[model samples]
Target: MRLNRRLFLGNGAAAATTLAAPALLAEGGGKPRVIVIGGGAGGATAARYIAKDSKGAIDVTLIEPSRAYYTCFFSNLYIGGFREMDDLGHTYGALAANHGINVVHDWAIGVDRDAKAVSLADGASLSYDKLILSPGIDFVDGAVEGWSLSAQNAMPHAFKGGSQTELLKAQIASMPEGGIFAMVAPPNPFRCPPGPYERISMVAHSLKQTNPTAKIIVADPKAKFSKMALFQEGWLEHYPGMIDWIGEDFGGANVSVDPDAMTITIDGETTKVNVCNVIPAQKAGHIAEMAGVTGGNWAPINAEDMSSKADPDIHVLGDAADQGDMPKSGFAANSQAKVCANAVRGALTGSRVFPPKFTNTCWSLIDTDDGVKVGATYEVRDGRIAKVDGFISAPGESADLRRATFEESEGWYAGIVADMFS
Candidate 1:
């Protein structure tokens, strides 16, 4: 905005090339157009930051499929009965009402990179000077044997929030006494490294109170998982004899499921389960791939700015971003969003850009008032977001510390929702 021509040359593109894009790519006086896709931890935060900081100097449009976003971060707690579904749902009304962001509720079906536009499910195309995609994740085709989207009703993934979470909770509540609950854990490089284990703990917490005799069987493709020792210790202390974890050593990866029969086969042994929660291998949402930004499963990004490695004018955030060492967590997504927001604002408005510093803490509830966490502070190192310092809850932390940890997660939930929407 400092110079008349600067608006057209956002991202320092040459004037000739910038004009080759869609006609909506702001000219001399037109405000730069920023289109953000998705409205969760990453996209919502990105849109809010860009809109608030730009202060009407930039046109920010947020496209999301849902009016009320359900966070996947605390969905496990919902399954554990610690929170109701309503507690996790947040509306975009606040974003539009307060920030002047054009919040459009629609699904992004495709992207026209040459034209610098996004195609919507409703047949509308939005032209963008800069595109921010944080569409979360999608399951890999046939990642789990005999498990597919059509079978989700019977074997609910419940990986994403909302109705699937509710369905999983209802299925758990309807589980007969002494019934077996099986979890088909995903392989490496999936969303939320500690998520499935936390869910197991939460499910155990629920079954202990309602059906103590119920058993949980976790079939994990990986040999070990995040905070394995801490979760195992907590399981022994709180819900002893409730969880049986079968890792790769025990053919846990050699699994298949029959949704109709409600049976899971692990290493040629088929067991009937009252509820089957399948967490399949994950990749960036299809829109990212459709945009030709994804390297493989995830969209690779520059650690310094969260800009796409493929396209400097495009950014990827949240679970979709391959930012090296950071795990796929709500906290990590929000951190990356701020860095991307700063970089994008600087590109479009010629604002002062700050050095990027990112931190992420993944907290999981082991039981009531019993929480454990693993976290790290990251910086640009070796051309990727690499850990500089970190911390994790120990195997035998004090009950007081664990309780405090649970309270901390609650506080974080409130702060993050406000950070994203309010």
Candidate 2:
């Protein structure tokens, strides 16, 4: 649906007076201003929904450095050489033209919560009646020795799905026929729990075709991973002898990588590899800390409204929020964005705000047609995210369901992008 500019302008004028005070809502008959930081899954959805639902009652501005976003969700397909960059990348033209969102191609350097303004790296300040922050995860430096941003040039993380992904793909292509490719999995509460394994599967798929003698070694800290059984079954059946997963017991817990030496140590044993993808521990994006909205690595928010515990006028969603029982995936972020949007509209318009129900589903492709998924419905109880019911793909499921899941995942991606940008 397209935005009704005239209707939005009129309603926004009235909303500004009620929410931001008559003086702040309009200096000379303007709409209520909203500044959203980060234009990924959560922020983009929040900005689009607020502008659409407000009908001109909210002037939405989105701050993001990239004009186009490369989704990490299905980026493995690109690594597998089955999809092009354009297939996974998305632009914000719809958000700008149809939704009337002011898309700012710049970074948010800081937030002055007391002043209700955000500072951009371009030396501009954006004043807002309400602010939304959905900056995704950031890798923790020093978590793995010799694995830093500078060293990533040699051992790419490929976690955020951009140039790093391409770099990792090139490394995979250059591996010797019998070379070893090692992956260092991160700790818990990180984005996309099944991501590392899926990456392994995709890379192994490519290796099996090009370098059949190559091996994939996953050095994981965790004993059990999401969809472990499904992933293992797929690996053994499809790419047998090529993929080897090492759990904590198998000298896999805790890693220290030396980029200079090009070696990774686990449990006092060192294994030099042709390529390494070390995904370090993650935390809320840097902006969350600059805004003083986070504790430790995550921001705590009221589950019902998604407003920060420290600042009620500011909301934090996506991987930045400490949403218990919710896997930090793009689907979860997109779902949370809608709930936050409804709450913001209710609060600003003096309408009734009901308790919210959050739902999420994450799909991972083990191969071109084989996929696995996990889903859950959540609610707020005792001021925390609590799961009500859900479904995970059963191990040893029929091949038909596995194939169908992959197709369904594509449809879900299309729908979510439309919901966010269109």
Candidate 3:
């Protein structure tokens, strides 16, 4: 659950030695050391796969602040009362003991690309022959007026899946019978394109059971979203009276919020709500930007290998990388991590790294038994992320298929967690 002094010092020394002697391979012992920052979907997978496939030829050290991770992919189920925190929470001991990944429970504060090292908040530095960063997104200050990290204690986003989630869950639990719960959906190119709507659906489902008179409002910046028609159909058929979705045309769009007032304005009209969940537009993790790995909102990587354009020795995946045509979802992050792992291995071992095919599937539950999905397969071509042939979801499918897909989503989550920390 935590990194010991021996492991930390050993990892740091291994990283330095590996970088210092790039061409040397010790007889029967020495292997290239890889230091990965952030043990979420992308970083965890990269650490596991590289350790598995490379045998003892690669040493992987994963740095993350938390020992357990709660996935956003299934946290909406928690809101729907279909699951619990323990059901979704995953630990890193298996990654350390079984997969040979040295897990560091610490935060990375600075990245020195020139020295090929990462500085920790604890005044230690981790050197790396190759660094993989999948720190995910950070909320942009001032993007939403009057809402910052401190104010999040009162108005929880629950987007990152930690204490914020618990706070939001408690707020929902203690709401008055007829109270209004409002959610402000972020703009495009954010993590999980269909996440906000799916969250609303789950919240409304819960409200229907606990407080029949409670109202759920969604103030969305976008006119349309992923699986728009299907979500609307499900809401109308299931929780029609409980949900109200306001689009841009109806003065529902806003770029900012007033946290102190607990009010949000759109088109010169301010509305107050008992609970507010505001998801701000996102960009690559701060470390990536510090290392000059990103453009405006995301890092540009060579899609063939998920190698950073700024520095080939470092690979950036997940929501941080600008994978064209790929929606920023946990599925995408997991898929890209495997591709990056293989590439990292090949880069270190002098093996042939082939062009990889990537895939993503995002499933959203509208209610307990009803769900919708979107998926695509992709391949790198001409240095860009491109969708491959035969990549589509079965829309307007049979009820049996939808139910089966929901079940399959659960399986996929388990498989992905295995592919990462298991």
Query: For model 1, which pairs clash?
Result: none
Predicted structure with the largest TM-score when compared to the true one: 1
Q: Best candidate per lDDT, number?
A: 1
lDDT of 1: 0.88
User: Which tens-of-lDDT digit does each residue in 107-139 have in candidate 2?
Assistant: 999899888989988899999878999999898
Model 1 is weakest, by summed lDDT over 10 consecutive residues, at: 12-21
Model 1: per-residue Cα lDDT over 1-422, one tens digit each: 01122221132121112111122337545889999999999999989888877777779999999989999999999999899899999999989989999999999999998889999999999899999999999999899889999999999999999999999999999999899999999998978899999999999999999999999999999999999999999899889999999999999989999999999999899999999999999999999999999997999988888888998889999899988899999989988888888878778877767778788889999999998889999899866999999999998789998888887788778878887897
Root-mean-square deviation of candidate 2: 5.2
lDDT (Cα, tens digit) per residue for candidate 3, span 195-302: 998898888888888987998878787888898888988888789788888887787665456778877776677777788888877889898888788888889999
TM-score ranking from best candidate downward: 1, 2, 3
C-alpha TM-scores of all predictions: 0.93, 0.92, 0.91
* Alpha-carbon deviation at 98 in model 1, angstroms: 0.9
Sequence-dependent TM-score of model 3: 0.91
Cα RMSD (angstroms) for every candidate in the order listed: 7.3, 5.2, 6.9
User: Global lDDT for candidate 2?
Assistant: 0.84
